[model samples]
Target: MGASKIGSYPCEEIVVDIVVQKSEKIFGELDVPPSKLYTQFATALALLAEGKSTLKQPLRTKDTLAILRAVENMGATVKRTQEQLSIWGVGRSLRPTGNVIDVKNSATGIAMMTAIAALSPRVSVITGDAQLRARPMPHLLKVLNNMGLKAYSTKPDDSPPLVVLGGDVRGGRISVRGMNPSLIPALLIPCPYAKKKVEFLSCGDSLQLNLALDVMKAANVKVSVGKKLSIPNQPYRPFNLRVPSDLSAAAPFVVAAVLTDSKLKLNGTDLASDRGAVLLNILKKIDVKVEVSNKFVLVRGPQQPRGTKLDLSLTPELLPIVAVLAAMAKGRTTISGASEARTMKSDRISAIAHGLRKMGVKISERKDGLIVEGQAKIKGGEVDGCNDHAVVAALVTAGLFADDKTIVRNRAEALQTSYSRFISAFQELGAHVGYAE
Candidate 1:
């Protein structure tokens, strides 16, 4: 399995398949809670295994549930007691009895489920929705194939419908580096059961490297990294993980506050996140007022934000939110070095441009990035989410200041990836928002 060039189309409909839970009172303008998607899924899987597992502040997102569903299908039971989820591991010898295990639209689910499938003697086929299937899985497949696991795509282009023939894993070192680095950790999840050592050579993607470290540390897989790394043979250990809040999810709110004429404070976030800090720097460059405290970050909307050029390749996840901020800025903003940003399953730059253009914002697509020329005022119009959660959030954020009502079709779709409680949060912040059944 190797990385291949694939073309993707702009999606038309963004369907949000969430039954909004009962609305609860806002706990006094607190910074939103941490919502780590990967950690939540991993925690659920750990809880389903044969052990006492503790997950702290788990993020309840679609991808996380998809992973938990996979674990449940594999004969593991999970229980939530008090504030923590208790997972009873079914051990490594457990096999999934099902024939078709659908992972839905979750990338983490596809990756982890496929990895879990490799551990069992049962032949399992992992599939997902069209969007998830469009996402690349060759990186994980390549790693598994390297470890002597018989894994193949049911289709010619190496898309989903992955048929994994489970067997004994002969672990070996594999080199992973690429534009989409998230696949690195996905490849490592199944390596603990390997009889040999597994080494990962990070190609300088910080997020991917960090995720790999987190995964290795959580599974208690002895991993050593420097220019190179080694994983020692070890028994798979279940971990009690506390999922961190998603800074990516909070970016829109942060940008919205920056664009408005109010001082907004977001609590329960890590300013230390690479993406968070990068956004802060971008704000500073654009002359947005910001103050950071020990526990929270406060952003004051500039009378008008000054736009500038940025290469957001390292922090591509923030592109959509940042683009929204640019849409409200005082100059031309250019985002480059983000051609690879499309790999995240959301063509955020293009999506924002598409939705905003309908709202009378001047947006143009560059070969590798986007250009947004801010206007003094923007009129609201109907926008579509296009099946991208980040795009939905961006549209909602943009709509907040629009002169008229900006109806976002399928706006609720954002819950699938992150920010499940966005509508309520917006309402709590005094925005007049409602959903139409």
Candidate 2:
């Protein structure tokens, strides 16, 4: 699989279909790295344009590699030296050979591939693993549809095996509701290349807004945000970005520290990072002591304080980890303003409720959020990951204080999407853990 050919790249598929057996010992101190969510996507897209791009401190995850591989498949040249990645894009257009693009379990790869395919004149079919196919794509689809591009699932219920007819996009006003802001970058990247101006109407608050703005600015697109956006008909520059360590990935460890009454510190995590401050506020309400410096967050826990209601619409990624914390707090906690959260993952709140219930924890669902009753003690038992990364992380966090050993099946299945070394990180923190191959 040389990097120059369009259709000769070798594809390796990996599958894990069992529970992750829990380690008896709890985790100890550990130092985590920076956020990498936006960096990887930005790099892959940069490789689509005909220019040289420099990406710094990029995320080195499987999804990042998947995106890079797709870019390589489309005839781009990417070289990595030390900590920097240099990509020479294939130019302004991709000649799609009507190839079948398989993205495996990478959601970032799927989203970026969808956008990149929009630039091609050929009909492209994009497919992934079963779980990746099951994730929602309506928000991305709606925006693409508004641009006069036809994108639909190859299977029923809008699951992937997505068929994209790439051509000139007739861009116009589009309204997106109940969608995560973190996903907006995937939509916005391709709009500038469209012939017409694209107007984006959103519900005003999304944590990914700052990241989207950053990407737009990097690409030299002038974006003005008020209630609505009026995109201009201007040529934008190609972009290169350095993605930080994913705060979303760091959240579960934050919750784990809180639950186990330990003093934990996360380095290379920025308070100015999207949703970090909001998560800190929520943890504060639950009496988790936190101190933020320029480069890290020092969290001291074991507060045993009362729980408070939260509106998690802006930070849906925090839901799974927060759910576990809320279940262990002293009083009932309510999380609202997150009806859109369900759109991200249909089984999210329900899955948490089910896992907690099985562990003898009390929780209920509301119209817009969840209501959780804290338990004095959580009795560990067998749990299912539901093929969601956050769910798997939450189960592991819960295992920290369980009365008995907690086992999480299919936890490793989600590592392909995010946090590939999650289990290894647990081991680094002194947790007793192992994986069965």
What is the lDDT of every predicted structure here? 0.66, 0.67
Predicted structure 2: lDDT: 0.67
**lDDT, candidate 1, 96-132, per-residue tens:** 7687788777776677677777788789899998887
**Residue 350 lDDT, candidate 2, scale 0-100:** 80
TM-score of predicted structure 2: 0.87
Best by lDDT: 2
How many backbone clashes are present in model 2? Answer: 13
Per-residue accuracy of model 2 over 156-271 as CA lDDT, tens digit each: 67768788887866778878765556666666667777789888787365656667666667766777788876666654456666656554567877776655545665666455
Off by more than 4 A, model 2: 1-33, 178-180, 235-240
The 10-residue segment of model 1 with minimum total lDDT is 2-11
Which 10 consecutive positions of candidate 2 have the poorest summed lDDT? Answer: 1-10
